[model samples]
Every structure is written in structure tokens, then in C-alpha cells.
Target: MKKLFMPYRGAALQLKNHVVMAPMTRSRAIGNVPNELMAIYYKQRSGAGLIITEGTSPSPEGLGYPRIPGIFTDAQIEGWKGVTSSVHEGGSKIFLQLMHTGRIAHSSNLPEGHQVVGFSAVKAAGEIYTDNGMLEYSAPVALDEAGIARIIDDHVKAAENAIAAGFDGVELHGAHGYLLEQSLNPYVNNREDNYGGSIENRRRMAMEIVQKITASIGADKVGLRISPFLTSNDMPSYEEAAVHETYVQLAREVNRLGIAYLHISNNPGIPEKTHQDIREAFANTIIYCNGFTAETAEEKLQDGSADLVAFGRSFLANPDFMERIEKNSPLNELDYNTLYSPGEKGYTDYPELNYISSITS
Candidate 1:
């Protein structure tokens, strides 16, 4: 069998295949809670070995996007229970991704009393979509020592909640210029305290969160996703050497903690040496995501670059993604419209191979 279709047994994850479903935000969670529609959506695409859920806020303050789900409340946890149960019934492991959109947020998206907070008070130079249409990002309240402590505690509790909700594990959203990645960027984090200044200081918040979460929940049930050079969400480019060192150091520390995996959000800006360095430093499973077809993903697995590969748009468009790959069938094109709109039109209405065959016959 091909490496991509072969079962993977490592890092305490025994997956049915090496293919993983990358997390993509589909704003179908009405009232900021998962529902039966979301459960059906996941169950349809459970052909992948592992599914990392969409960005779920760990607290009320982290709900920076309109309609994104949260795991902080009892209702949210109960909602996610249905989704996890469905995924498990389909014979796939699922992980809840805890993402806190820090400076990359507008006040209109947050709850009544919660305000946007981040490592520093600097606002990201971009507009986020809200119910009131595109709005400028609100100025974040720079977190003091107490605020930072609270953020860490929130993550720990979120991870615990994920396990309670029937998740196989939890993945920390340390990539994509979210709250954790906000601290890594020096241009955004201008604090003079211990959590700022040097490379060690810049990575302190993320490292502390990983360490604490691993302590609270076993290291085997945790994964961290990171993008070293991809400057999404108004993140400015810094010194090249500093960027390389920051992630390499991070890989080493996480390796020491013995986490389940390190998910690298692959991009063109990331140098080959950095990839090699990260692979050498971290001995656990490493998943490479973004812009991969089955052929390329299979090559990545065979070439020893990645133990597993994740597909975002492919799974989003094709529910039986693994089946299509196995049969060498053409994939359905993704509809640009309704990517984040409510309802099941472009979300769960995608046809499977059987449906296509029936129509043609």
C-alpha cells in the first residue's frame, strides 16, 4: 500500500491512514456553539485518520470571529460532544483546536463584557469580517502578568474540556497570527517585561502554554501548530535569523516536553534549512499542511519529510477524500461562495463518488 494510505502508528496516535483533515473555519456554528449540522459535516469527512477541528475559542474573550464556536461554556462543550461522538463513530480520531484571535479582532465579534486582549496594545493593520460587515481591528488591552496567567489557565481548562467532550486530544493554535503567535512576533509584542525582548522572551507565552497544557493533559494528547515565516493576519516580517532561531528553539523545547506532534503550516517563505532543522530537533510526528494533493502528499510521506499530511480544501470539497484518492478519482471543485455563510448549501451538500456515479449511470 502507498505510504499515505498506510496506517500510522507513532506518538501515541494509531491512525487508520496517514491522511489528516486540516482545520478550516466554517462559520456554521450558530450562536457560537456546535450543532447537529456540524456533526454530520464531520462524520461525512471522517475518512481521514485524524481531524483537527476548526478554531474554537478557549474563552469568551477569544471569540474574535463572528459565529466561531467556543469550548469555554457548558453549552459549547455539550454542543461539541455531538460532533466528537459522530467523528468517533466513523472511526477517526479528532482534536479540538484552541485558537484565541488576539489583536486580529473587532469588538463587535466578542461577547457583551469580554474585550479583545493580546500580548501588547498594538493593533493589527487589517479589518476582520463581522455581523456589521468589515470593521477595523479594535485596539487590544496589553496583558499584564495576571492577564497572561489567566490566558494559560484558560487553555488548560479548555484542554480538559476537550477530553471531557470526547476528543482524542487537543491541538493548540500557535500559528496564523493568533494570540499565541502574536507573542512570537516582536513587531506586535513591544513589551519590555520578561515575556518580551529576546528570542526566549518572545516565545515564553507559547512555551508556557504548551508546558502547562501538557502537564494538565498528558503530552501524548497534545499537538502544536506553528507557521514560522508566513505573515498572515497583519504580522510583519522581522529579522530572518531571528525568525529561524525562534522556531528552532521552540521545536527543541516542545521535543523535550514529548508532545504528540508539531504541525508545520508549510509555506513558500519558509527556508529549506529551517525545515531540516525543525525535523532534526523534534523527534515526534510532524504534520505538513497547506497546498497538497494526494500525489504530492504521498511523495512527502515517502521522502521522509512528513509522517502525515493534512488537506484543507480537498476535504472541504470532497467528503470521501481518502476514497477519491485511493480510487484516483477527480475531486470536486471548491465553491468560493458560502465558504463561511450559514446553512448547508456549500458546506455539507457536496456530492460523494457514489452520487456522481449514480447521476452518470
Candidate 2:
């Protein structure tokens, strides 16, 4: 519909359309720094209304996956400058996703002095892919009061670094079993202190990070992604009632703080009414993401439930995804093998529809 193509003006983000390119980990940031190749990859897909980058660690301990980008070091910030500038030149707003992997990590992925850490001293179930191969996740050290402070400080610094790197804003990765979500999960956060126990206490770390980051970079420039039902990376699913109660409270509190947007990862079990409830709770923008087709996204927009729709695989495989949807052109198949492998083979090699047609003709 025409609504999906209409410009969306948020508190901090002004996009040319409502199609959002979801944050997806491509694992191409060689040596944990954003590079020119990453710039070219994002630049190629600048047709999206907004681009939320791949998961980028905020600190050394947050490095759970090999080759994932970071914003802590000066070199990382300088490296991201090229990415931000390229995307901007292509006429799209981009947000840097700040992700901390928590217990879902191996020591080899971390810096020499840094060890894996999380809300509790729990070890995640599955193995993580390292440079060597599949390595089992190690039990993380529980964060002390000082460690908690450091994590919050690192998040704020990462947000500042993203701004310095020319990003339009920063999106705190609070979902998909990352550090923030780990703290929110009742199964993972079994601590006896203020950060554990009731839903309010369990949700404290994420709340504090959002508040602190908003303090450092204004609430208008801060966004958060949440998945209350995600079971990946040892995240446990809470009961339906508990999930609604916990996340609705989170939505309300963050809405009071006036955040730019709340990015929701919608799954099967989570009801549509729940999305509507969160939409009502938040004041600014709500981006619903997860296996969405253009038709369904337009329907959601028409129903007034979501302001934007974020596509992950579609945008990844189709560099001109918006254009393809507009013209009803066929989409390219995703190569799962190269999704995490290094180099530009599948990273920046996905061709635009027009380019392919020109060559064929």
C-alpha cells in the first residue's frame, strides 16, 4: 500500500519509508572491527527505509561470537565511520545495534584478560562457533555490583562511540538471549540481589542501561529490541501471563522515558493482541519484525498495529528488497552456508534486481 512507502518521522529518525532492514549477524567484521566491505554491503541495501546493523559488542567480555564487530576501541569507531557515511550518502538512516552476548560465549572469543560474564553463574546449553570450530559455552562469572556498573558504563560508552562513528542512533540489543535479555529471563537470572527475583528486579539491568544510555545520548536517539519468548542461547520462555506482565511494564516504563522506538521480534506463541498492547503502551514508534512479507507488513500498517516492519532474510538476500516488492520481482534464495562464513562471497555479492535484468537483457 501507499502507506508503507510514506515517510515516517520519529523523535530522532526520519525515514523515507516504513520498510526496516532488521539487525542480522553476518559475522563478516574481520578482527572485530567494521570494515570497507561491511560498508559496501550496507550501502548496497540503502533502499531500505532504515537499517539496523548486525550485532556489535560493547565491551571485550561481550564478544561471544568470532568476527562480530565492536564499538569500544577507537579503531572500531573509525572503521564504522565508513559504514555510516556510506549508508547516509545512499540516503538511509542507520542505527548501530549494541549487543552483549553474556553467558553465551567462549573465552577464545573474548579478549585475553576478559572472561565470560552474565546475570548468574549459569552455563548456556549449546556450543558456540569459534575460530577453531564448535566450542561449548563456558560458565560465566556472576556480575558483582562493580561489574554491573561496568556493563552499564560500557553500554553508554558504546552508544557514544556509535554517535562518534556517524550513526544516526543506537539500538540496544535487549533481545535474543543477549546480556540484557539474559538478565530479564527468570531461568537465567537466579541471583539473590536486587537484579534478580521478581519481574521488576529481573528487568532492572536493561532498564538501567536504557536510562543511562538515554542520559548520555538523549532518549530520542535510543531504541531497544526485545523478544520475551526467544529460546535461543539458553533463554527460557516465561509463561504467557508473565511474559505480558513483564514486557508490558517494560514498554510502559521505557515509553515514559520517551525512547525513539521499541523493536519487537514477533513469534508464533506471542499473540497479535500482545503486539497491539505494546503499541498502545509505547508513544513513539513500534517496529514488528520476524518473517514478514510485504503484504502482511502492509496489512499490519493498515490495521494501525505497527508503524514499521523489519525484514531479515528478505533484505539480506535481496539488496533491493523494497524495489523487488514494489515491482513484484522475484527474490534471490539465501545461501545458508555463507551466512556466517567470512569474506564477501555471500556478504556483498547478492545482486540487485535491475543489475541482473540488465545483464540478462
Candidate 3:
């Protein structure tokens, strides 16, 4: 009864192994299009089993990181084609994460002549990165029902674009207080309309996007990422329940449609009870990320708490992460200084499995 490299078999798709590289935004793209260098970076890690590409805007309004890629434009799609080709040649599957930043944005990063939009007109707390250092976020314009419908359409178009770009599927960026999460957060969303007021209503918009995208491209090609529960003790109780209920309801709805996966990010500082809820709520493949060491990943996998583990910072520093973990090898500590810095020095220059082999050769 020993399975060192168990395959990840879901309802419709199958990954060669359980090691999935979590999407991390590295500001290295050009004009919001991933470059040839970015392609090589991901291709080098084809050993990850499954690689979730960096958060890509589903529309101009979804812009988060200044240099991050998008799935909207032909140029963007063509840019991703190179990346997909590279990853495929290395023999791996990848998903493009459709990220809509919502209230978590500044005017500088928006499309030319574009304004930020959100579920509510309220402003997000703290500073957002801008060309002129970090600046306070301005109050975003609340989306009318028409605007909400348009965004859903944007996600659908992006899903189609993802498929054309050679992505295996698209993962909706619904967590981390992004646009979808903003709708679910009571603190952020104070609307009295059908998209708000109650937990069911709060979860409505995200569900609609899921239904639209999964329909546009089969549900089996779609995945959702959420960090419904936060480690911040500062979050209100109502917000926590809304997050919890949203995840459960979204999972049930999408699970009914046979979606590929649901990724839940658990901040290490949070209480343990949330794990019990995630275990009971998600019936399909549930991927757990955030502070998951190798031993923890194995433990949770064996216990059926999660189907796969998403390694973020570790994968950044160690491109051969899957092979390393498979062989119980040590990892190179990540260089935080280079983490979103403007260069390939730390991004693509990280050592690969062959490099490590040569060291031992």
C-alpha cells in the first residue's frame, strides 16, 4: 500500500502527479504579455506535474500586477501560445488563472483611460503598488447589474481565449479579496440587491461566472481558487461565514457540473477548525496551499483533506520541486529580494533538475 507518485484523477481530467505549482505573480512580462523568457521558466518546471500560470486578467479591468499577462488580447493569446508550447514540449499540463482584481487596484495599473470597478463603491484598505511607489486605493465604482453581466461575459471570453492559447483549462481567481471575493465579503459588499444582502446572494456572482465559463468551455477544464477563511483575526465573524458558505455553495454548484478542481488557501496562522469545514464541504479534488511543507502535504493527502498541495515560494526557488520532493532532496531557499524584482536574474535563472543532477554528477 505505498504510492510515492500517485496520479491525480478527477472526474474528467488527469494529472500525472499530485504536485501542482501554485500561481505566483512575477512582474516580468512585457506589455502584460508573457515573454519567451517566461515560457522557458515554466517549461523548466514541467516536472511539477501541473503548473498553474500566473494570475492573468480576464479583461482590462482585471489588471493586478503591472507586468502580469492577460488572456484578452490576441497578442496576449499569442504570447501564451509560446508558453503553452514550451510547457507541453516539456510534457506537462497547465491552467491559466483568470484573475479580476476588483477593488484591489490603482488607476496607474488600469488600462489606458480605464477606471477600477468593484461590487461596492468602498475602497480597499492600505496601499496598492503604482508607478509612483505605493499609493492609497481610490474608491472603486460599484458595478450595476449590467456591469456584472458584462464581467461574466469577459470571463467567458477569457476562457475561450485560454483554450485557444493551448491551456488545458482556466482557474477563476475568486479568492484573496479579489473581485469575486469582494462580492462575498460583507465588509466590502454592502449591496441590498440580488447579488448581495445574504450569504446565498453574496455567493451569487461568483457562481454565475463559474456557470458561464464552465459552460463556454466544459466544466472539466475549469478550477476555482479561494482563501475564504483568513488568518487575520481582524476579519469579522459575518465575513468569515460568508466566505465559508460561498466556498461550500460554489463547490456544490460547480461540483454538480463536474469542474476540474477547487483550490483552498489556508494561512498557517488560522485556526484548525476551518480544515474540518473544507474537508466536509468540497466533494471533488480539493487543493490546499499556504504554509504546506512536504510532510504536511503528504499527511493531508493521506487523510483525504486535500487532493494535491500547491507549493508557491518553494517552487519559485526550486524548479525541480517535484523531483526533489519525490527523492526527499533538499530545497534552495528563495531569494525574497528578487521575488517580484524587474529581472530574469532570479526568475528564470533558478537552478533546474538537470543542473542539480550535474552538481551530483
Best by TM-score: 1
The TM-score between candidate 3 and the true structure equals 0.93
Candidate 1: tens digits of C-alpha lDDT, residues 1-361:
8998888999678999998999999988998999999999999999999999999999989999989999988998999999999999999999999999998888888989989998999988979888788899999999998999899899999999999899999999999999999999999999999999998998998999899999988999999999999899998999999999999999999999999999999988999999999999999999999999888998999999999999999999999999998999999999988788899989999999999999999
lDDT by residue (1-361, candidate 3, tens digit) is 2232677777665877777889998878778887898998999788877899988998887785577788899999999999999998977889999998887888888879888998999877777766577888766899999999999899999999999999999999877778888887787789999998887888888888888888789988999987766623122335555455666676677777778888888766334666666566556778888888778888888887778888899889888887787777889888887777666888888876678789998
* Pairs with backbone N, CA or C atoms under 3 Å apart (clashes), candidate 1: none
Ranking by TM-score: 1, 2, 3
Kindly report the root-mean-square deviation of model 3 from the true structure over all alpha carbons: 2.3
Residues 133-221, model 2: lDDT tens digits = 89899889999978999999999999999999999899999888889998888889999888999999988989999999998889988
Each candidate's lDDT (Cα)?
Answer: 0.93, 0.90, 0.81
Identify the superior model by TM-score, candidate 2 or candidate 3: 2
Off by over 4 Å in 1: none
How far is 336's C-alpha from truth in model 2 (Å)?
0.6
Give the runs in model 3 whose Cα sits over 4 Å from its true position: 1-4, 231-243, 269-274, 356-361
Task: Give the C-alpha lDDT of model 1.
Answer: 0.93
Which residue pairs clash in candidate 2? none
TM-score of each: 0.98, 0.97, 0.93
